[model samples]
Target chain A: MSKVRFGVIVFPGSNCDRDCYYVLKDLLQVKVDYIWHQEEKPKGFDCLILPGGFSYGDYLRCGAIARFSPVMEFVQDFAEQGGLVLGICNGFQILLECGLLPGAMLRNQGLKFVCQFIYVRVDNNQIPFTGAAQPGQVLQLPVKHNEGNYYVEEETLKEMKRRGQIVLRYSTKEGVVTREANPNGALDNIAGICNERKNVFGLMPHPENSSEPILGSQDGLLIFKSMLQYMEDGEFRYGGGEEFRYEEGREDDLDA
Target chain B: MKRVLVYVTPKKGILDPAGQATQRALQSLGYHEVEEVKIGKYIQLTIQDNNFSESSIKEMCSRLLANPVIEDYHYEVSDV
Candidate 1:
């Protein structure tokens, strides 16, 4: 293909479709198209994005209803075949609902909808999503959600840690991961994660919302740029061995 | 016709913020004996009697109505 094509599947209530489309099309200047939720399976696209918003009015759960959309069946097949897929905010919720990524989101521990720019430390920059970022670099990203509190059973969490599927965590500007820095109290401050194959990634942060300086931060654009780079030049899938900074409170930490 | 009632709730040991908030609200309202309040979803589905199967209902609950990762679900079927 001359240019890498991207498809942003728009669920019925997805409000951030334009934001993602704008970044991939206008800012990144790539071949991008929109796939309505009811549309047929997508083909010929290098990557697919599930943008942020209250799909199906977030009925039953943040992503429960949206997961069953016709396009998602194709998305599941796409991710299984190692095609790159990224989900943002509510999109991330849908990914979880569909078992694209392991874990579930609970209401913010504080019981409020939090909307703010928070710093996130890139835990594993080897993944395509963070290839352009420096190792352990703290990126200022915006997260707006009520149910961004990520939760996974303990045993699976250990396996995720061992495999480095965790790719980002809420953190201080100095790249320090701390409990106080966590906005929604996501378990171990997880903000972003990828699957074991590293082909599917999901994060509660809204990268599109912060993709430009005019939006108050251009830090989020790095994610899009890196993904584009991967489409063109990436030949290997990365599995990481970096130490997670938020390991302080895990079961193993107490033993140590 | 048939009716299915699915009840979904956060699994034990998982934090339930909305439920906790409700508990606090009740306490503030002088319902101190209401030691705990946990919120969950109740979904009622109307189905064709012949199309309703126990396995299918369970599948729907496990796949869509409840996320087994952090929530639990149970459903009852009744004639309508």
Candidate 2:
């Protein structure tokens, strides 16, 4: 099969850009390139990665300032055209800030920066991002962040649950969902979610950090493989995803 | 010159961990009577343009100064 081409975005303060590049190019042997935040071109890539880190030094909110980067416009356009987008940690924040994904992140419920290996249950395996895993599989991943507490209104939560938008949830290694297993008090234990269209995914855990066996887990590699598999299937092409408007998404209605 | 004061606060239903932590600290320091402490951002912008409008400032707050999803913002414009 042909290799999957991936583009990893690099905002000014994104420290994980190189890590993502290493995983895709060295580990997976896939064709990958770095797209600086100022550049608008995201041409001819099967997938895009918004790697984790303090974009804009987490100023004015973790992902707020970086969301306005020129490259995001193209990324937004790409996703609407049925391209796959994966956002990790700070990348998730930027996606939320840019309205590529729904909900907002708040400070960790304990008000401390949390850095540790945690297990997350894959709530849905039917979607492209988690398709390589079993429906209730638990994967070990590391999360390092200060603002990883995901918050969404109760009604939106219900709607997302119905659409299978809620894909990952913090859980015990045994795959039990409980408050004690939640590392960051995210509402509904949400560690990750996808847009209703299933093309854009954002997760707080750093899959790039734990993609190799030496990193103590190879489970992270499954996520990348899923993207590769989805691309190879060649199903979701130019016209499969739902219509997406560039204006702030579901969050706008919440202000009312 | 004109000054714009913008206040961005967590929305009514959103949890404010920072504010809650501060409140705990204050209460521990014997300010037990303090019922609540809500944290927010106070921004001061000095406009050199005479045409600076309140509507524009409001838009600024809505667009960048505050995230409408989990926060609310209000601004005041006055002569500096």
TM-score winner: 2
Ten residues in sequence with the least summed lDDT for candidate 1 chain A = A236-245
Instruction: Output DockQ, candidate 2.
Output: 0.78
User: In order, what lDDT does every prediction score?
Assistant: 0.88, 0.87
Task: Give the worst 10-residue stretch by lDDT in candidate 2 chain A.
Answer: A237-246
Candidate 2, pairs of clashing residues: none
The TM-score measured for candidate 1 stands at: 0.91
i-RMSD values for every candidate model:
0.8, 0.7
lDDT of 1 by residue, A1-256 (tens): 3289999999999999999999988888899999988876667889999999999998888999999898988999899898999999999999999998999999999988999999998888888888877778889999999999999999998888877788989988998788878999899889999999888999999899998898999999988888888888856333344533446445531123
Instruction: List the DockQ of the predictions in order.
Output: 0.87, 0.78
Candidate 2 lDDT for residue A214: 97
lDDT of 2 by residue, A29-85 (tens): 889999888998757788999999888889899899999889989999998998899
**Candidate with best DockQ:** 1
Q: How high is the lDDT of residue A35 in model 2?
A: 89
Docking class of 1: high
Q: Please give the distance, in angstroms, between residue B4's alpha carbon in candidate 1 and its true position after superposition.
A: 2.7
